[model samples]
Target chain A: MSHVGYGCLMAVDREHVLRSAAALLTRRATATMDEVAKAAGISRATLHRQFAGRDALVRALEELGIQECEAALGAARLDDGTAREAVRRLVGEFESAAGLLGFLYTENQLFEGEEQNAGWSRIDARIAALFRRGQESGEFRIDLTPAWLTEALYGLFASGAWAVSEGRVAAKDFQYMIVELLLGGALRREES
Target chain B: MSHVGYGCLMAVDREHVLRSAAALLTRRATATMDEVAKAAGISRATLHRQFAGRDALVRALEELGIQECEAALGAARLDDGTAREAVRRLVGEFESAAGLLGFLYTENQLFEGEEQNAGWSRIDARIAALFRRGQESGEFRIDLTPAWLTEALYGLFASGAWAVSEGRVAAKDFQYMIVELLLGGALRREES
Candidate 1:
């Protein structure tokens, strides 16, 4: 194969490995590197060559999660229409990354005092800014701060992912469950 | 000391050990039993005498969590007031167990196919029933199911616990953050 073709193939291989690792880790946080490579249908040697060790693999996963979240945020068009509509769109766009996000959400607990990847702060700021926009526009309640709302969004997304995994909630309904509950809540609206 | 007095003292020691273990494990799920004993200011021998092993200790924590939840539910007086009021009361009462609940929430992921403690089912049903009661009373939206609502509540509780631990949200506002977000959501209510 041509050098350029080989390079493109390697990029695709890396993407595939990262996704497989996300899926495996999402279900079982304790999965070994061999387990991760096996899930990716690749050799452990190839996996190690790609990621030097568990820390490297995890860092790669964090990078992938951040990229996917950023991509989702971009696709959601957070600046479009009303803040509620933007939130709905964001939840819908983020559905595909729910598993990876859930994995990262729990893995983050292990960071302790270690420096977090800067990508997360960027994503958090963007999301919190969206919440702040809603609050400023009088679309969202002011009593609940944007920071809390952002954190709650993360919690709901992880919960929705787990619910879908356990078959307690339908995968098709993931976006509706999160968006409706986050924006509208469990209370019945007087207008509705 | 009399036999009864000795038994009572042993019971108190066991409770202390369990709470210490819960607090330590809440922060570090991978903490060793020796570490747990150390946190409780007891010897490993005494810890083992109380709890046969890690599984036994975890099972004890689960029981404690379940009992606390049940107590909270009973105190919330689900049948005596408006659904929103009941929810607020429940959140207030459950705050103390948030850390232990969070610990158990992550720990349960390891049970994969192993029978979950039956106590959880009872707790789940009771909580879900609260949502169902709200729905039947026309207090909650019909779009979200009780099961999803229950899962979301659990998610938010864990999220609130973590946020409080990380100092992202004030420790004092834990109940308010969860109660308001879960029942009322982020949107500004027409009446409020």
Candidate 2:
């Protein structure tokens, strides 16, 4: 009981730090570790006690991103409702983490040659499965493969994040813009 | 006439080298300068005479990317027909240069903190205008802003290019996938 209690306490602090860092870096990818520590509402000495530098912080953020994605997937209940609805829910749940995901997408060059974290593959597989379900259900078009749709989701998330950060698009509209563009496209649809 | 001929000849060689470098780097971002020289079918000495190193090579490529984008825009004739047809034509015209655009998009970190080339602003504004044209004509959804659509086009292009490069999606399907998803989306529409 004592060990479990200690582990839970540590995780809460670590999670808070990761969330704070992600929110800052999502908008400003070049922010310093000191800024991250400040954003997390902790002293620099306390922050350094956990992570060494920006690189270490980013590595931790990657793990946090993966965990958050998994949590979103679980919370969305992807298989319970219609795939389209499922997709909408997933995007909404991801709204909080989109910034982190965007930062990771742009900074992927860091993992260019090195083997990327395996967690991404896991998250991708789950999302791909949802798209596949949509195709099987006849709710989606077949010409665009599930794989392509999955990749496009990542691209849109990055674009949406950047657009919001640049103030070109309202942050409030991020989920709507991406969901509408991904599921319905730019063309105005006639009432059926 | 002699001076014009000399300039034209130099321009042709320069264009050829940029295309070759863009093509090679698009597939393999980490390819060596020596490899780029071989891909361009030029000697290392000759390549160095033109550009000293990879940094100079990328700078030259930036100019080539801008020139190619401007050329595509001109050839696309964005105002010629229905905005939809114009967009389709613009994308098709950009096909040959997508690889170069993709390469530059990923390597954009190299330009961070520096003023980006003005040509990008020029290109972005033109593309945004096309979306604005479409919206004004009721051809597109007004909720999705012109700026967001333009950014989405760029995101789709990068996604399509990456999908093609990775063999996750077929190369031939690149343009169709991006255009269809951008224009019609993943929903199956009832034919009017």
Candidate 3:
């Protein structure tokens, strides 16, 4: 029991450190390790012990993004309602991580010439599965493939993040805009 | 006159060199200036004369992208047809430069902390104007702003380029996927 408690404490500390690191990196992608340590109110030595370098920190950020995405998916209950509603729920839940994910999405150097972390594949699969479910249920059009839709989701996520960062898109509307555009598109649906 | 003939020759050569540079850089954004000169079959001196360094080369590429976008916009005839049809034509014409445009879109270093090229404003206003036309004609839903639509177009262009590069999305489907997704969305339209 004592060992389990100790393990829990370490995990909690590690998560706190990662969260602080992510917050700093999201604001300034080029921030150095020393700055990260400063922002987290920890010693540079401790930061080094946790993440040895910039690349390692980015990898940790990528891991954090994946964990949060999984958590959001779990909370979204994407299987509970109409696929459209489920998408709305997913987008709503996913909005909090938009900044972090946007950073990871555009940080191409970390991904180039390397096989992406398997966590992303799992996340993509889940999202694509949701799109497939919509298609199977006749809610989504069948012409666009699930893979394409999944890719488009990431693209929109990055674009929406870009818009918000540029002060062009309001943060509160990120979820509404992304979900509406992805699901309903820009055309006026003629009501009967 | 001989002067006019010489100027014309210089213009053609410069455009040719820029086109080759664009093709190479689109394939490899990290390609060096020496490699660009080599690929363009021009001497380093000539390449340097034309572009003093990578920054200048990139600026030239940006100019090329702007010029091509203008040409595509001209060919698209954004003013002549129904907004929907106009968007389709615009996307079709824009497809040829997707690779080069995608390069410029993601090259954040070239644009960060710098005032964006004025050419983009002209291009964006034109595209946004097209969307506004759609909204006024009741051809598009109004909840989504024309600015957002224009921003989304750039996002989709980058995404479509990315998909085609990864072989996940076929080249033939590039225009179809982008146009259909941007206009019609993913929902199955109810044929009333």
Candidate 4:
């Protein structure tokens, strides 16, 4: 392989290691730095070279979350399908990253004063915009604001992930649970 | 008032004091026992007499949450109203005790053991039954399980409370936000 191709592969490998460590530490908040490094399957020196310390590692995780959200939005084909389909796609993609999202949700609650990494705001705006578009297009009900819908989606995502982790709900049912509750609600629809 | 009436009043007052303390401490988890006593407006001795220690205080708080949830279930009039109205009432009442609920929600997450407080299970069953009733009566959609709907309600309450506290969302809109998102979802609904 060319030197440039090898370097690209190396960067991708580093990103994977960082994401694995972040997911582990998020679940096990008390995990020592050494534990995190070992969990990533990289030596302490190599981990340090990739991320100077725990703080740096967390920040990278935050970035990864933002990036994944953006990627999900793209893959969801928000523009091509009905808003309902788009939301289902978004929720489905989000399930893959639910653990990390749950970690970040709790972390944000604990550390409210810190400036949120800007990427979340951008993503929030994008998601909220989708809801607004649905409303404008008469695809959604008028009573709820887009802003609230976005926040509620986040809440349900976090809740579903935690419930699955605690074994209160089955893992396979996560996507179905969130999508149905969010869209059609708990009420039984009347037959026309 | 008669002796029995006086005793009943005193019992009510004592319960109120304990609940107030719980609400305060839930928001600030690290509050001292003295601070809790002061918030309750009772002397440290009286507070200790009512509850043996922090553990006792927490247990009482949990009991209070269970009772309040039962009361809300009764007041929500789940049997009479449309599922949407029932949910709105449920979320509204749940919002009042949201701080304590949030504390318990996070606490339950840390507790990996099988021994959940029985009161929680009772409350969960009652709420889940309400959802099932909605489904049976044709007031709610059937795809989402009653269990996940109940869990999502808890999660949204916590998130809404936190968001309001942090000024991300206005306090006035808490009920509106939770109900709207839980029912209508983030997508625009199609006009029939």
Q: What is the TM-score of chain B alone in each candidate?
A: 0.93, 0.89, 0.90, 0.85
Full candidate order by lDDT, most accurate first: 1, 2, 3, 4
How high is the CA lDDT of each candidate model?
0.90, 0.85, 0.85, 0.78
Best by TM-score: 1
Assign candidate 3 its CAPRI class: medium
**lDDT digits (tens) for residues B1-192 of candidate 3:** 457455544532788889899887776777778888898888889889878888888888899899999999999999987899999999999998988887887675235577999998999999999999999999999999888888888888877887898788999999999888899888899963
What tens digits encode model 4's per-residue C-alpha lDDT throughout A136-166? 8777776777777788788888889888977
lDDT tens digits by residue: candidate 2, B20-82: 898888877778888998999998888888898888999888889889899999999999998
- Candidates 1 onward: DockQ, in order: 0.79, 0.49, 0.52, 0.41
lDDT of 1 by residue, B1-192 (tens): 467556544443787888899999899888898899999998898888888999999999999999998999899897778888998998999999998998899788877769898888998998899899999999998999999999999999988999999989999999998998998888998884
Best by lDDT: 1
Q: Give the per-residue lDDT of model 3 (tens digit) for A136-186.
A: 999999999988888888788877877888888898889989988998888
lDDT (tens digit, per residue) of candidate 4 on B80-104 = 6676778889888788888788877
Query: What docking grade does candidate 1 earn?
Result: medium
Output the lDDT of residue A166, model 1. 93
* Model 3 segments more than 4 A misplaced: A1-49, B1-13, B41-46
Rank by TM-score, highest first.
Answer: 1, 3, 2, 4
Model 1: share of real contacts kept: 0.78
Poorest 10 consecutive residues by lDDT, candidate 3 chain B? B3-12
Best by DockQ: 1
- A36-91 in candidate 2: lDDT tens per residue? 88999998888988897777888888988889899999999999889989999999
